[model samples]
Structures are given as C-alpha cells and as structure tokens.
Target: MATIFTPGPALQSNSSEQNRFMEKLMAKILSFYDEQSLIDVTFKVSNPTAVVPAHRLILAAASPYFENLFRGEQGNNPVIEINDIDSDTLERLITFCYTGEAPITVNNVGAMLKAAIVLQLNDAINSCVDCIMKNINGYTLQAAYTLERETQCERLKQKLIEYEIKNFMEISRGVEFLSFDVEKLQRILESDNLNIPREEDAYDAIKRWFNYDVPARQEPLPHLIACLRLTQFDADFLLTHIQPLPGCELLAFKAISWIREPAARTKISMRFTEPRATCEETFLVICRSEMNYKLLQYNKAEDKWQEYASLEIDYTNYWPILKDENILFIGGYKNGVSCNIVRSLNIRNKTWQNLPAMNQARRGHRVVELDGKIYAIGGLEGNKVLSSVERYTPSDGWEFVSSLTVGRFDASAEILNGKLYVLGGRNINGALKLVECYNPDSNTWTSCADMTECRVSLHVRVHKGHIYVLEKYSANQSSQSVERYDPERNTWSKICCLNAEWARIENVFSFDNKLWSFGHPKHDDISSVSVYDEDNDRWVKKCSLPNVDRYTYNIVPVALLSSK
Candidate 1:
C-alpha cells in the first residue's frame, strides 16, 4: 500500500520537477559524507550512509603526498582527520606541507611529533626535530629528550648531540639514552666538524662518557676534546668535564686549548674571579645609637646581617675589635670616660662577657688578633698621641706589648704575612706616609717601606696575597690609584685605579677575596659602591649600600664561618 502511494505521488509530479528533486537529495548526501570523511576516517568508513569508498577516503587523507599531482587543478578534496591529529599540530603540519614552514610552540610539539611518526612523514619529523633542538632551553630540554627517546628517532638524537643541547645534559644525573650505541656516540664525540652546544648537560654527558675512573685503552674522543675549547661555556662546566679525567691530563689539554689561545687565559681568569658582596652583605656605618653592641650573625644565603644580642656599654668609638666565632670589643669611649674595657660577645651563645681592660687607656685605635692574641694598637689617650700597644690573651688577660716607633692617631693596621703593617695616619702634624711593620716573634717595630702617596682616613684591604690601599690625597681631591704590595718581594706595583669618589670614603672592607668600599658620604651623587677586580685589574660598581648613613664610619667584615 505504501509503495502504491509513493509511485502515485512520483507519477503525479512533472518529470523535470522530479529529476531536480532527486539531484538535490543526492547532492546533500555527498556533502554530508565529504564533511564526515574530513573529520575522521573511522567515522566516514563506519557511517551507514557514506557513499565515498574507504580507499579513496584514505588517499584524500594523505593529500600532501600527491600535492604535485594537483599542482594546478582543483584536485580531489583533502580528508584530514582532525580528531586523529591535534588541531594545532594538524594546522602546523598542513602549513608545513603547503609552505615548507613549521611554527613550533611548546604545547603542540609532542602531538606533532607523534603524528609525524605515525604518518611516516620524514620531512615533517625532521622539521619537528629541528624546531625542538633550536628552541631547547633549560626548561624545555627534558621534555624534548623524552619525545626523541619515545620516537626512537636516531636522526633527532644526532641533531641534539650536534647542537650540544646543554639543558638536556646539565640536569641529567647519570648516563641517559643508555641503549644508544656507544660507538656512534664516540664517533660523534670525535668528529672535527660537529658543533656541540655549550650546555651544562652536554658537558656532564661528555665528562661521564670519556672521563671514567679506570683509564680506557681506547683512544680519547677528539671531538669531545675540541668541544672543551668552547670559551662560551661556564667554568663550572669546563671543570666538570676536565676534573674527572684525573691527574690533570684533560685539564692540561683544556688549559692549552682554552687558556693559551690568544687572551683566553685572561678571559678565563676574569670569569673565575670572585664576586663582590651586595649591600646586604656590606658593613654599614652605624652610629652610637644604632650600634647595639650585639652579636650579629651573618646569613649567607639570605645575604643579611642581624644583631643577636645587645650590650650595656655605648658603642660610639667601639669599632669591631677582634672577630672569630666571637666578636671582641675593646678600648671604646663609653659615656665621657675613655674605657679600656675589653669585652667579647659569643656569636654562637649570644652572650656578652667582660675581659681584662687594656694596659693603658686607648680610643680611636685598631685591635688586631694574631695567633689567638689581641693587640690594641696606637690611638688617642686624652689628646696625647700614644705609641703604646697591648696584647690580650684569654688565659693571661691584657699585657703590655712593644710600643709603636711613632705615636699616631687616625691610623690603620692590617695583619699581612704574619706581621702587622701600620700605614698612613694623621699625627698632630697632618698626614704621615710612614709604613712600619711589627714582628710578634721579635717584639720589635721596623720601617719596611713608605707609601707613594700620603693619605689620612684611608681604606686598606688585602686581596690575592697583595695589599691594596685606597685614600684621599687632599680635602678637595681624592686619589683612586691602587698600589699592590707583595710581602714576599717587598715590592709595590700599580694595578688599575678606581674612580675618585670610591677612594674618598673611609668605609672599606675586604671579604671573599674582593675589596669593597661603601658610597662616599661627601659624594652621595655616585650611586654605586666600589669593588676591585684583581684579575681584570679594574673596579666595578655593585648595588649601592642600603643605609648611606653608615658610609662615614669604619666598616669591618668578619668571616663568620667558611667551609673549604
């Protein structure tokens, strides 16, 4: 009955009208199958109404392979399975196929690589590898290496080795890609034309592979040896590579290749030079009220100095006397009295205790510790210049030591080469250039040598077995000339000079093998504190001191604890 009705309705319509209607329905069905085939091959092949053949659908899906066939014509429609490939990866792959350009983003690299591998697309895979190697940094190395490993792509791994991808090797603890043939790796390491990336990971890998504990009878990898000449690499990286080779053979090769190669030694030396302390580690000039006479503990990581305890006595003229695990404060003017009081605050216990007073009343003096004994050198005693010196031992208390050859005030004392070197000071008659040395063994003072320039209120620091002197020549003029003194030869040589503003200040201290000067109070216009570089023979400006008020006072830096 239904067939009879359908035939009657078809017969009732005009022939041309019926023909147009059938054509329209067929067009709609073809369009639906085409759209579905573009979405997924499985969806198209499984669809009950799909009219397109499965083989044709598969060919359309791989349209990039037959691109030359449809170079000019409007060819068969491309049926890319969007679900099979990630949308971003699919877009990138399509762009690469069309224009031979691939845009690599971190998000789509993995999916793109997987799709390229699955489709057996060699160019696409290489493009993905190139993008990954080019953009690899510390953050992305691990992910990239993982992708390469999973794909089992030897070409990608070789590209990584060629680039010397640092990020991948630096953080990798042990041998990785262990399954990779050592012979191929050895060949790569020995290659002359290959350029390896100066990354931390590459250095670590090269070291682990070549510098084994037991000596290998196999010939050394020449390419790895050549890679060590890369000066752009970190010293720590070079050290890592050469240190494991044992007996300094690899190190010697590195030195010859890197150091002796045209100003390379200078560059290496400059890079390894110690860094200066920041404002946080700098000793600020704190006033009497600010000087709590507390045991201050230095936190290295935090780069901070904090007071641990407070003292009852005033700290006006109380300069940091002797510093060890405990800090000793002696011969400071307390209230109106010039106190000869000797006190120490244990940094560990955070407690203060009184020791015996000095043999004589002394203020404006410097206290130096030599061989576990404290010596209070020349200072003001009631407007009289005193040459008196006293030694303080914990067991025997304070005893009179040998006095200075000349009585002076506003002087500076430094312990160098097991001897006390007392330099320029303002006697009753302006500045004096007298440089004297005192030997504790002989209990005597001998004039060794004189400074080239006369300076009062100057800063003296020792660096690299040489003493550096910084001072102002006159009230209006300051000298930045740094004179390096060698104790062994008893000779002086001029290193690079700093700016006048840095040398003018009295607040200077040496720590961590670098000389540091605070910002000059008279010259606050200068924003940076001065730091002398021994290797470069120059002075650099670091972050300015936090509190500028402490620029005028004597700054002392004590090594709280150090592990060698």
Candidate 2:
C-alpha cells in the first residue's frame, strides 16, 4: 500500500493500462466506420457504392475536395457524395485519408489511383505506383502503361521504359512481345540502351512482330523499318532479308546511302552500332616480366590451363584476349619508359600486328573492351598519373574519347549493362575508393558509390549482370572481403569473405559462369585459381596457375573474353 502511494502516478504498474486505453480508443474509432454508428457520406462510381459512417470534420481535414466543400458557407452539411471514383477504391482512399495507409492490389490499383488523383492523395498515388511496380511485367504492361498515361505518372512510365530497354532481347521472345503494336515496337528498338547483341536480331524480332498479323501491321512497316540499323547488315543479309520485306524500299535506299556516303547521309536514320557477338566467353592470363609476354587461356576441353598465345616485348603491361582469334597488349613501362604500343595477336593464324599507338604513352593503365572497341583509361604517362583516355577501333585505329573523371593508375575496370565502370586504383594522391560509370551512348562519366574500403589494384568482373570487385591491395584490413555492385539497384554490398587471403591477385575473370580469382593463396608462393560457387557462396579451389614455375612468371596479366 505504501509503494502504491509513493509516486504521483505508478508509471510501471499502469504500462499495461496505457496499452488497454489505446486499444479501446482504436476500437471506438473503428466502430465509427460502421453504418450503425452514423452514416454521413456515400461515394459512387463505376457501378460501385460505398456507405461510410464518418465525421465530416475529419474527412474534410484529410481530403482537399472535402475541405473545399466544407470550408464554404455550408460547413454544417451532413451528407456528401463523390463521383468519378468507384466505391471500393473510394473506400480505400478514404480509409487511407484517415489511417495514413492505402490498401492497393494489382487488380484494383488503377481504380484506386483514379480515386486518389481525384481526391489529391499523393500517398495513395505512390502506393499505387509501387503496386504496379511489383506486379508490372510483359502481360500487365499494356494496362499499366495506359493507367500511367491517364494519370500522368512519371515514375511508372520511366520504369516501364527501363524494363523494356533492360530486357529488350529477352522481352522480344516473350508472348507479350508477340502482342506489341508498331508503336511499342518502336519504343524498344529506338532505345540506345537496348541489349541487342546483333542488329539482325532486332530485325528478325520486328519481322516476327510484324508478321503476327500481317494485314493489320503491314501499314506500319515503313515507320518501323526506318529504325533498323540496316547499314550494320552485310550485303548478303540486307539483300536477302531487308530487301525482300514489303514496304522496305525507303529503308533499302537509306541503307545503300549509309554505305556509300555515311558521313554525308542525312535522311538515313542510322543506328549506333550495337556490340557484335565477337567471341565466346573465355579467360586469358597474361604474364609479364622485363622482356616476356606469355598468354594462357583456360582450355575447357582439357579442363585445365594451356598456352594460348605470346609476344616477347620489352615491358610490363595489360593484355586481354579478344576471346576469339586476337589478343591485345597495351601501354606499360617499356625499358623504364611509359610506352603506348597497342599490340594484337591472331591465335588462328599465329600472326602479330601493331595497331596505331595511343595518343600518349602510359604505364600502369587499365585497358578494357566494350562493344568490340578497346579503351585505354588512366595510367602513368611519364612521371605524372594521367587521366587521358583513348579508344581503338579496327576501322578508325585509335581515337581519344572522354578522359576519366579521376586520374588513377592500376585501377580496375569492367563493362556492365553496356557501360564502362572503373573502380578503385591508386593515383598520385594514393588509393581511391571512387567508382565511376562511363556511358558509351552519351560519352559522359559520372561518379557512382564508393567502395566499403579504399582499394588499389582491385579485380572487378561482371557475372550475370552484376559487377564483383575483390580487394587486391588494402592496408586497412586483411579480411579478404569482396564487394558486389548491382547496376539495377545502384548499390554495393559486402558479399563473401574468402577463406584464403587474396594476395597479389594477378588476374580475376568469369569462367564457366562462375567468378574465379587467381594468384598466390595466403602465405603461399605458388599461384592458384579459385571459383566462387554461387550455390555454396564460398571460394572453391579449382586448379593451380598454368605456370607453376614461379622463377620466370612473376607478374600475371589477365583478360575476360566477353565479346567475340
């Protein structure tokens, strides 16, 4: 009895009483929703009716339409009617206005969104957009696209475009792609980010879409055919495929003009060439020393590493196999001077050819390939770390493209979603955690998220549309952690920490649909290869380096054969 009287209010003893009070208050508020309490409003639209028992003051305060009506001279009105919105959707919208939560589903989202828009409910609008996002796909896109257009939903429209562009090739094969009209077909083919590896694939896909209902779709042929990159087709494919198609006369003339006078052809709407299918995915390891360049590729048939191709030169450098017949070796310290000699070797003919030298000579640079073009990003040009960038094409030789936003040597680069991504590497300022993305379509470089830790000489590879980066040089921690970047989410997460420390990771590439990092294991002099098994989420050792003789092979150079 003394303990109870000791405090003004026994806070601990009444904690349960507070919960009981809230529960009773919520129940009382919920009872107001019943018609028995007092029905005040009715909403009708689209053949549905909602009879809601609610206080006019609460409803007016939550919704703009109600506010506009009640703020007038007749604020005391008891009954109100709302139109242009169905009863079930109005119920959800009204409930959301009261509880600050909207109930929405794919089936009723369109109706709910219309009600929310009429009532000026932003939260409900966002909720509906999210509902569509979770459920929107090939089958539902048409309906979703109509709803977005009707309501002027910017976010949903962008997402629809992105989904179409991101999965263009795959979407073309879907049943819904079979249902696409000419305008929808143009939307997909016109996107610069379309993942069409070959132009002919897009042509064939459009033809299939056109032939679905020939009489109805044939009229749009000229409009649709104008978008194809007909110039990318060889004479045979163009003559046989494009010429034979009806209503392709204008497109054929444009194609011929593009070939004869490509620079001066103004009427022809030539498409930016999509990446060609250059080669099958393969792994190549390049070992460098004072005057030796030995390349080894994973021989899948023998299930082991074998000698691929080699070029003896006077430098340390970066070289990756073109994944088919050719391999490239670029700028490095040649006889103690930064040199920019770009060399290539044909595996089939065993011949070597030297392309045009880079705009500048640089050592310790990262060389990457995208869409069959090679780019030489930042490296040490003379005594200064250079941010200058250059591109090489077989037709044009070497042309300087955009420079890197940050100047760093020995950075890691990879191509994902048709963009060049450069990750951590050392500059004169030291190791960088900066991540930047270069869009080939725009020729612009923009910064992305930094790494979990500052790193230099890291290894990055794209596997199944995700970029995986491994810490090759970091003093902060030796946990041997790896970071994975999802381009879709624009975020990075620390993934598997390897069992063995990644020391002097000479090369890392995707092989057999799995990420493999090669170098000497922790505290071991001999180099080995380990595969990251997604099923087990651990690094599984596969085999040793092709060269067990450590005496000659010191610096290992690597390349991923992503294009043919």
What TM-score do all the candidates reach, one by one?
A: 0.45, 0.48
| Residue 535, model 2, lDDT | 69
Give the number of the best model, judged by TM-score: 2
Off by over 4 Å in 1: 1-312, 472-479, 488-495, 521-543, 546-564
Judged by whole-model lDDT over C-alpha atoms, candidate 1 comes out at 0.57
Best by lDDT: 2
**Cα RMSD for candidate 2?**
23.9
- Across 322-371, the per-residue lDDT of candidate 1 in tens digits comes to 34345577776766666687777654355678778787887778777775
Backbone clash pairs in model 2 (N, Cα, C under 3 Å; residues 3+ apart or in different chains), count: 4
Least accurate stretch of 10 residues (summed lDDT) in model 1? 271-280
Alpha-carbon shift of residue 494 in model 2 (angstroms): 2.4
For residues 1-564, write the lDDT of model 2, one tens digit per residue: 345544337655787887887789767766776434655544434455555546665677777877886777655556556556666777777778667787687778888877777787777777887888788763287788678769877666667767887666567776777877666678777765565544655776888788788888878876777676566654545555677788886577667666666576676565543332321234555655435667666655666877666666666654443522456767767667888787776554557888788888987787877866788888887779888888887679789888889999878888765689999888877879899999999999999988887887777766545778876644434666778888778888998565556656666664433566777766676678788786677787775764443212211212222222
